[model samples]
Target: MPASISMDENMGFQYGVSRPGLNPPIQFGNGFYGAGSGLIRGGLGAYGKKICGSSSQYVQSNISKYFSDPQYYFQVNSHYVGNKLKIILFPFLHRGHWTRMTEPVGGRLSYNPPITDIHAPDLYIPFMTFATYLVLAGISLGLSGKFSPEAINWQFVKGMVGWLLQVMLLKASLSSLGGGEAPLLDMIAYTGYTFTGLCVAVLGRITLSYAYYLIIIWTSMCSGIFLAKTIKITLYAEINSYDANMHHYLLLAFPRNSNPKPRDSQNRRETISLIQKCKQFHQVPPIHAKIIRYFQVQDPFVVFELLRLCSNLNSIDHATKIFQQIQTPNVYLYTALINGFVSTGFCLDAIRVYCRMDNESVSPDNYAVTSVLKACGFGLALEEGRGVHAQVLKLGLSSNRSVRMKLLNLYGKCGEFEHARRVFDEMPDRDVVASTVMITSFADYGLIEEAIGVFNRARSKDTVC
Candidate 1:
């Protein structure tokens, strides 16, 4: 017999009496026995009765039973009781219980209920990996500060506040959904912890002041990682659904009606037509060859199209080769390359492209400047960002809204609130962007009241609500 069965039997006899008042005495055969045999049998019997009959045992069994066949206990107090306790005590640990309780009640409980797999490598690994990256970022930023003091600004604090708000929003949304049992406090704590790690990384990358940038970097990194993961999971689920396939095809066929002239209309039409034709005809030219033929004219737009297509196909080398072959690459061409590099998380490469533009004496335009600034942000190149800022001032581009906004953002990111404020004050007109930058700065410094005041003032103005 199985050990559990044997133990149960032994327990059944030792605690044979069903009621507390009743007692059943037994006499064992007189024989040489092992040490403590009577004690062992007695203990086993007592445990069996407790497991099988005690009020606590009954409650546990009922709870598990109700969970297995929820309809049987749909109106039972035990279900609610168990769920309430789980929510209060285990929070994040009992996500499934909360999910099940929230599901529509009429049908038989799902055999394989939808549950988020928390142990998936992607869920936790990226946060940890990015934590290391954050440390590096902090180091890099710290080093960059030696040359670029202006890189540190108030916007970093504001960005940090925005990040914190996002985290709170996410947690609230999750709790509102099926995550009532999710320990929100713990989630917030972990997020803060992760954020700190990232801030350290950013500090290591560039230096303005360790204290403020550290917080901003930490929060930004953690929040960014969490949001990215959540979005990816949601997208994966949506894309994997049967309905999504039909919708995807429909979207491709009809396309959105936003752009006046869809930028890639011809290419899209061809790609879609090619897919449909492939279904009917087995033999067709490779997609690349077709694309090459389609763009035979060598127009800058065509080159851009080919570059975009190649990058989408993960043929970066091919995209680079085509980019190099252009006789006279314009600012747009360089912007495309820079954007492509940034998209691929190659901040260093993007910076190099900006440097090349400088060497060629091609006065980097607004778009180019924006892209390079983004690179500086990513690489934590405070000095480079300051240099760019100086150039913007020299070129009288400081008045340009986009350039000024970027400068505000760059300064804030580097943890220089005063400089960020200076930029904000220098704006020709106080727009929503400028106000938001100021509000964010206050929030980053944990001056919630001040941030709210700014927001209220902006709302009262009603200029750009």
Candidate 2:
């Protein structure tokens, strides 16, 4: 029988005897326990391994098992099946363990799935539908004389096409979930779908036709659903990888085992070299520039990293001074400063930075808008928030989803339910974000019934909760 080890409050492991009848190598981590059993099982008192002769066989068997019994299927077998499917679909999902798992139990036997070309039918269908709609809408607009021949900038169209290509490149680099191995292709399909939908909407809005607006809205809803699902899958994949890594580390450092430590050797040298390269490429320069011919073309991402490093080193003054030197401070820069100040309970400083943005005519974007609104929500400066709202409207940014959401939140904070409702009613599209903002607003203001009503309405509209 495999021994069971449980950790104490201090994370010290204690061994427990497992009965012979019980599965061995039963692993427990965080709050969950799993047992392995069956032909591949080591009688290790761990989780049972669901066996499959082939990948297709595995998928078919698992699906049958799941749909056949709803209650016990997911409860008992879903995790293994889901994990296996993830591996089959995205072989690189678990880099280290995948290699180990595929290796033979004892001999040199190797098990690997055949490389198969996969295409996304779900993506293709929506893409084709949206493309058809765009073509029709564009033709309609052209015939209606809404698109003036001289007004049409082929350059802008070219730029938009370039933007689509850039988006595909970005999606591929980011390892977007739905795209998987064919991220570039997947992103291209998604971009086509999004472009067509937006084009149709633009055509409709230009023509001021309600029917076109209705079509645009319907298409948007469908697109949003697909986007949300893609995001969900990506997030799920990330979380699973994180959990697997944690488990692998825990297993390696099992009871009384010292955590692995790094050594100053060739490996360390390689690591340091990599870190320096990353800093050079990805790190932002210090906010301060000492009249260098031109500021080093550092990555904007480096700024956050530098700030984090400064914070860790307790060089608050240095961080602050660097932040002050930013030429065109964006929402991210302001938010970082605001967050640092708020964390240190320097509410006044946070407010001052917010005011500075307006004074400098920088025009606070969504992040800045949200931070200030949050400060108001906490009853720090309701009057200041109201002023920001006026500025937002004057900038003609009130219609932006982010700004509107912030405004909705601010109105709720001020206990102005009517104002919040007006903002909600004014939104061109009542998306999940809009609905959530309203629901959260009601909940925050102790309006339970109103929150529930908002939730019900959202559900009725098929806005996934």
Candidate 3:
């Protein structure tokens, strides 16, 4: 038996090292210290991966909302990204910053700050950091006399592959946890953050090879902590909300009575609201019939809703039938009919309807002009639209914001830069939308300098250009 050894009550072997001048070293029973330490390390590594994976899962679960546009994800709102790359590399050292949540609507990108945002998952940082890391890494390799383009390319590919693996792991973990349905690109953004941390380690290696290991340790710890904390906070609701709302969509198709009965004001409002929600859904044939039954075939508003929805759905023929049923169509209904025709490639039909309105001497509202001009633009009949512009001027509506924008859009599309610029210049009050339209027009026409000039001279910094 080894000296300075004892058996414990639990049957764990206790050992003590005999030092020349000490009674004995402190006892470590059985595999107490060794096994515990090993287990702790294993648990930490597994837990780190698990938490990080959950973080990815939470993001991807809302993938359509978050990851519909890859460009939007990679695009950093200047307001949010300003002076944050340095801090992003060492996120633990600098807390309390968030990335922008952005969406592209009608060819314009809008940004909003997330209610519970963490900065690490910003695609801007990942994209920029990945590029910068590769550049810095190449420089390091070059300095060490081991530079090769092939090797640098390999590193880039390897990093991307690693990011992909992280996304897979995250997606798999979340799916297993009953939260699978996250966006693929959102997962890409989250997993892609490795570049930010790896960038720091690469810089350290460039400075001193020994520093690489130390910085890597720091970076790994920081990543684990950030992901774990953020995941717990962000996904707590997401997991539960997802489950609760799992049946929400199925419930949308509530049991429709064999015949929808006319109800009270509250019921009518709810029916209209529900119809509005269902407008985007592809199953509109039944919905249209349901709306007619609900209104008992006398509500112009019901017809208006169906018309507008049919336009969006490109059901131009159906909308025309609904339009015919309206005994007295208001400007809103008229505009909806025109918009439906134009949106669904029935620009000629839209124009004929406008001519009929003119014959009937129906006063064309701003929406009417906007819809007609848009129809002209879609039809590529710039000359006809110019005549419509003349009518708009005669009606003293050129000053209308929407009219000017629609007219400007028309001229820009027709390759009439001079006309487009003239309208934009003549606007009494140029807002962000006007500026955005002008810049977009200039860009499309290959007038890069003009676009840049407009961008620089904009009074409002909020323009999408």
The model with the greatest TM-score is 3
lDDT of 2 by residue, 6-27 (tens): 1111211111222232222322
Using TM-score as the measure, name the better of candidate 2 and candidate 3.
3
lDDT of candidate 1 over 1-465, digit per residue (tens): 000111111111222223332223222112112212332333335433443454455455446643443333223243433443233223344343111111111111111221222211121222343444544544465665632334333334544575478558766665453323333332333344343345444554354454655666555555455445433333222222212223123234433333334346677676545534442111212443454444432456656655555444433444554665565677787787777666654454565566556544567788888887776665545556666777776667777777778777767666667777788778777788788877886877787997788789778888456
Best by lDDT, which number?
3
Report the lDDT tens digits of candidate 3 across residue range 152-248.
Answer: 9988898888888898887787677556465465567666666778888989898888889999988887776655544443332234332323312
Clashes of each: 38, 17, 4
How many steric clashes does model 3 contain?
Answer: 4
lDDT rank, highest first? 3, 1, 2
Q: What is the lDDT of residue 249 in candidate 3?
A: 30
Lowest summed lDDT window (length 10), candidate 3: 1-10
Return the lDDT, model 3, position 281: 27
Q: Candidate 3 overall Cα lDDT vs. reference?
A: 0.61
Each candidate structure's TM-score, on Cα atoms with residue i matched to residue i, is 0.37, 0.33, 0.39
